[model samples]
Target chain A: MENEFSIEVRDLTKMFGGFTAVDHISFEVRHGEIFGFLGANGAGKTTAIRMLCGLSLPTSGKAEVAGYDVFRKPEMVKRNIGYMSQKFSLYQDLTVSENIYFYGGIYGLKRKVIFQKTEELLEKLDLKHARNTLIRDIPLGWKQKLAFSVAILHDPQIVFLDEPTGGVDPITRRQFWDLIYEAAKAGVTIFVTTHYMDEAEYCNRISIMVDGRIEALGPPAELKTRFQSQDMDEVFVKLARG
Target chain B: MRTIYFILFKEFRQIFRNKAMLPIIFVMPVIQLIILAYAADFEVKNLKLFWIDKDQSQLSRQLLSKFEGSPYFRLTQADMSREAAETAMERDEVDVVLEVPAGFERDFLAEKKTQIQLTANAIDGVKGGFASAYGQAVIRDFYGDFLEENAARLSWQPPSGGTINIASANWYNPEMDYKTYMVPGVLALLVTMIGAFLSSMNIVREKELGTIEQLNVTPLKKTHFIAGKLIPFWAIAIFELAFGLVIAKILYDIPMLGNLFLLFGLSAVYLLVVLGLGLFISTVTETQQQAMFISWFILVIFIFLSGLFTAIENMPPWAQQLTYINPIRYFIEILRSLLLKGSGWAELQQQFYILLGYAVLINGLAIWRYRKRS
Candidate 1:
């Protein structure tokens, strides 16, 4: 069924040998929705996201991302989605400008368009002076901001941020969210996974996964009220404990 | 096409930017070519020979003269005593000593009996063998003439020549320059080392640095990525082969008897096999260390069996059979044959076809094993 949602997963499961990582999990993400996929370590969040990004195959069931099947048309899924993992997505040896052009070139952007987009990104991120600085020499916070900007550079239909701000200072992370808000305002669907509860409140909707199953799915305030807790941390603790 | 170009651009940038790897790629072959061609030499020539003649007779003079006439032995002294000859051998100034006892011509004329002694240093077994054999050949020839001269004095009839004369000459490399033979083999080794070691480590480095994961998420095709990785090394290895060949010709006067195009054509196909093997190794290994170990294991086996130093025909039956599977064996055979014997397509078709089949199989396996997902 084609609807306002950009992603629809049905009974998606992944098995390594006999152990099931993601067992019969299903979900839908609306267009331009800021989806915060929340789970404890080893809750199959990575497994599920890998399937949606078309980087991996699902053992059974179906997933459609950007109107493309995750199983049959993974390349199509990859082409339409921008992905950033918390574990350093940019090339360390390449200059800031070089990384931008290289990533843009691989995305099949024309030279002129990559140049134009690079200029806009540099100006927006206030990185005009550090264009030739190697990513290795750049500070961690600036690197994160640059990574986020590059991820959405292609104007992909959806952006997957896998723990994009893990060790950044509070102020830098606050500014990082500002960039996310700017991208969301431009109608790009944001699919972010993070451990921070305050980051959960910023999402339009969130799903808490427990033991390969979705225990709760709703707005943070609704989940807080339903769980009889004041914050997402407590809601997470209540669902994860049982 | 555009994707392939971008990947190539990125790969080239990284390769050139690497400070530790740049000198290894460009400078190493030149050094190895000059040093190993001379260092790895096995052919023995110019044996230093010192002789002591106590008889001072015409017969003893004839024997010493025979050694001087030969091209393989360089005569250092004729009047030196046995003790002096021993000192020369000890000082490493001579490889052999020939001592002729005080046997006048009367012994051969009256009784046809005499004795001579030849001693050789065997520090290098092959060199010693050549020296002893050459010394014996010179003595045997002198004996043949001596027997003919003394035959009339004896009561028995004897023929002019005692043994059948076997005529032979060296072919292909007539001069027997060891460097001429070894330089091509060294070239083969250099190319193999570069293609196998570098290609094996390329993907593993990506895996270690977490770039492979980033690249996998893009719209880039797997074939484009592999090709981009393969092409740069392929070009570098082929360039190394050409560079080595030029050095071999200039330094060693190595014969380039065959078609240069065929050598390069076959090298390109052979590279696919080794590069594919490298890529296969990389796909199976997680870290650069694992890939390096595996690559080294495979390279060692291929090099030993390639007939660079020893002949494959000399190997035992089972070992000879094992050499059939080695890609290096075929390439080195093609290299030596084309470089020395000037072999053509008809002479080298079997080796070429084997490498072609090997290339397809190995590259196919490498591509199949490479997973986009963890």
Candidate 2:
């Protein structure tokens, strides 16, 4: 049987010593979909993302990422996914072009291809002038855009973005979403977690995790109608509080 | 291999871009080399001496003059009473006192035995002992002279030379220049410092910045990652050794008597041992501060027992046994033999094998501990 989903989980759980960080939860995301994983802080979203990305082992569960079993085929899962955390993902001291080259090279891209992709990326982002500037010297908005581009530079089947737009202005946040849409159109699956509820509505499907369990799941319009709320923000509040 | 090249390129860029790191890696070791070589000297000189000559005889004056003539002792005051000399010693103003009794010359003429009383301040016991030994040597020479004059006056003829002749010569550093003895050991220490600290700190810095989390998710192999990290600092350590050797040659006239390739070959193996140990420490630790503290703890223990400043032979049997496991000790021994004694590979084969075994063991363990995912 051919499984068409980019990610599939069933009764997935993660425990830290005696504490269960992620309780038994399951979900499926199709290829080329922007899946918004929303939760309060410490709601086990990051832990779930780690499990899917093959960075952490699930305590007792089954997860398939990019058509590979996360437990038995983690390296395969890793090779097919890209990861970018808000706290990291780029060498601060390296120039923009060097960072691109380094990450691309690590993904085993040829030097000629890396050069071509770098030129295309800098031009598309309108960052040609800052190509030689250190990432530390660039603006935070530009860094996020570059980080997202680098995460998808290998053209992996799935790209996991953990709060990739935190602390940016509303304009840059929307611009970052534009980049995400562009990537999804290119058939790259996006597993994004965010604190911004407005960003949650932009996802094709959304899951709200509360106390290590997914409290709500569906499209934004349906979730709003079901909760009798105006938007994802109110719907999220009702799920988290009630 | 290509993955490793990418990581290596990034590490080199980061290392060179940080303005403070390059200076710390290059300049600080050289400065420490010059200063510590001069400070770690063991040769004693310029001892202070005072005298009370109650005899006031020609013999007493002559003996005192002998002490004054030697470069090791400086005569400060003369003709003081024994009590005054004691006072100066208590005040830490004098190092030694020579008291000649009143009957010194008279007893000698009457063919009776005579003695001279020598007192020394024992606060710095080693220096005091050296000063007293020098004083005794001068007196023995004077006694020989006195007997010679007497023999001439009496026309006395001996059967043969009375004493058995003893000839002592120091080999391998005939002048015993302490700098010559210390430079190679210091160079070994410099190599160890750079290799251990830089590698450990580099890994932990990545951890602290949360960059490791990004790396952990990548498809990068653990062995490739470890090799990539080790190679950059390994190259830097070799560079540092070459730089320190040039400084050692120019500043101290240290002769590089053995084969350069042999020394460098062993050094490369020794660097792997140190860098591997450092990488192992980093894997067990989480923060740069924790890594630094652990590295410092082990490095301090290794350096003190390395026979760099002191002789390993003088240590207790168990401590000497402990040095066998110390890579720094083997490197220091290899360096000293090569630079000072011109020892060849056959003489240093044992150290080479031990270091090679340690390098393999440590690096294997380090690579095992480094997991791409937990």
Candidate 3:
């Protein structure tokens, strides 16, 4: 049963002082599933993702990531999961290859393995020329793609991406999703949080969080039908207003 | 271990790549050392003086000439009026005012003593004290010579047939070079200031750059991350200290009487205390700016309480008590005692032990706090 699901949550709650940031929410993500966590700003999407990534402890309830309990086995969970934060997290002072090597090294990859992976990743991203270039000098779209690559470079069971494509253009967002689809095809489960309804449509399944509670959860087509809407955008608007 | 190594490699790359970091680590400390050693001077010299001599007798003339011969005093005006000299002092023209009144020889012959006024401007108390002492010595010398030469003419008998002579010697610093006294203290400061500043700002810079969040979500051990961050800065600071010591030896000729191994050993432990304080500050602060602000505040206290500028014994009792907790004070004391006094480990074991305790306590708290937070 644990092998079938990548993430298991039952009544996961997080609070800061007197304010409840994440209410008791329960969900499960299957192996290789593209699960979109959609919500407006301050709707607790980021907080929920933080708990799944083992970056924050839940105030109450049981949660497990990549078959490891987040509370009891957070270190193990961290070992099995990869994360890309909303804010760009690569060392801007380091070169692209240096960034790749650094993340791979921390993830416990062998130096030879890191070297091999570096050549393969640079070729695949068509960034071989920019390998020696500083991250600050790189283009924004390329930087985002590079960040996502570094996050999953460890070959974690699940990859958590929090608003991985916030400020990119529509074409770049599509290009970013192409990378996500390629990873999903290779049997990597992606747990991503974003407010973009269009990106919600690309997910196999998504949960709409409203004020710390998951108001709707289903396939995008099913959600659109259930809300009597044309697309995820209309469904989100109707659900948010109610 | 490999994780720590990787992190260290990455940290070194970033540190070396940073444009401002190299100068901050290497060039700036040496610059500060040379500047501070030369400029933090305590010796005062060439005190300016004004004189008002009313008596035309050879006694008064000879008294005025005595001041003229001394190297310490610069007699700017010889025939200035009392009112004019007082005005000169008021206007910051002279550091001292020498006044010899009329009938000075008659009064001296009758009473064996006469008053000669030496007034010093007390704006700079140290300079004023030196000025007054130098002036009085000259006047006393003139009086002694006059009494000896004119003994038959005046028929005056000396109160004491014999006078006591005192001889003084400066032991460790034979030349009494203030540079020798200041070099070790400033070097200690150079090591502590730059090391603490860099370490304290390290983690917070990651926080500002959003890298800590990324690292937090990974399998990298907390202890490994801390060690990686600290080891590079620690090594760099030790290397910088060695460089400064070499410069001190060549440039200032500061003595290194104690064992080099012991000095380096103590310095290593002392750096841990400093770096740990920085790490603790980094963990608590939210931004690099806040961390830098707190580091500045702590550094100001460290420099002042370390007795780098003023002797700790001379501080108020309360401030003296504060030095008990200041790590920099113990460090500066250890450095000076080793380099200047040739103190052995047994003589300096107390300082070594206190620094060890501090290293353990501060690093423990910083590690515990960081682990608890994550």
Best by DockQ: 2
What number of backbone clashes does candidate 3 have, counting pairs of residues 3 or more apart or in separate chains? 0
Could you tell me how far off, in angstroms, the CA of residue B257 lies in candidate 2 after the best superposition? 1.5
DockQ of 1: 0.61
Clashing pairs in 3: none
Give me the chain B TM-score of candidate 1: 0.86
**RMSD values, in order shown:** 3.7, 1.7, 2.1
Expressed as tens digits, the lDDT of each residue in A125-236 for candidate 2 is: 9999999999999999999999999999999999999999999899999999999999999999999999999999899999999999999999999999999999899999
Window of ten residues with lowest summed lDDT in model 1 chain B: B103-112
| Docking quality (DockQ) of candidate 3 | 0.71
Better by TM-score, candidate 3 or 1 = 3
Full-model lDDT, candidate 2: 0.91
lDDT of 3 at B276: 96
Best by lDDT: 2
lDDT of 1 at A141: 95
**TM-score (all chains, Cα) for each model:** 0.89, 0.97, 0.95
Docking class of 3: medium
TM-score of chain A of 1: 0.98
Q: Provide the overall lDDT of each model, using Cα atoms, as 2-decimal numbers.
A: 0.89, 0.91, 0.89
What is the per-residue lDDT of model 1 for residues B211-309, given as tens digits with 9 covering 90 to 100? 788889999888888999999999989988998888788878899999999999999999999999999999999999999999998888878888887
Ranking by DockQ: 2, 3, 1
Model 3, residue A90: C-alpha shift (Å): 0.6
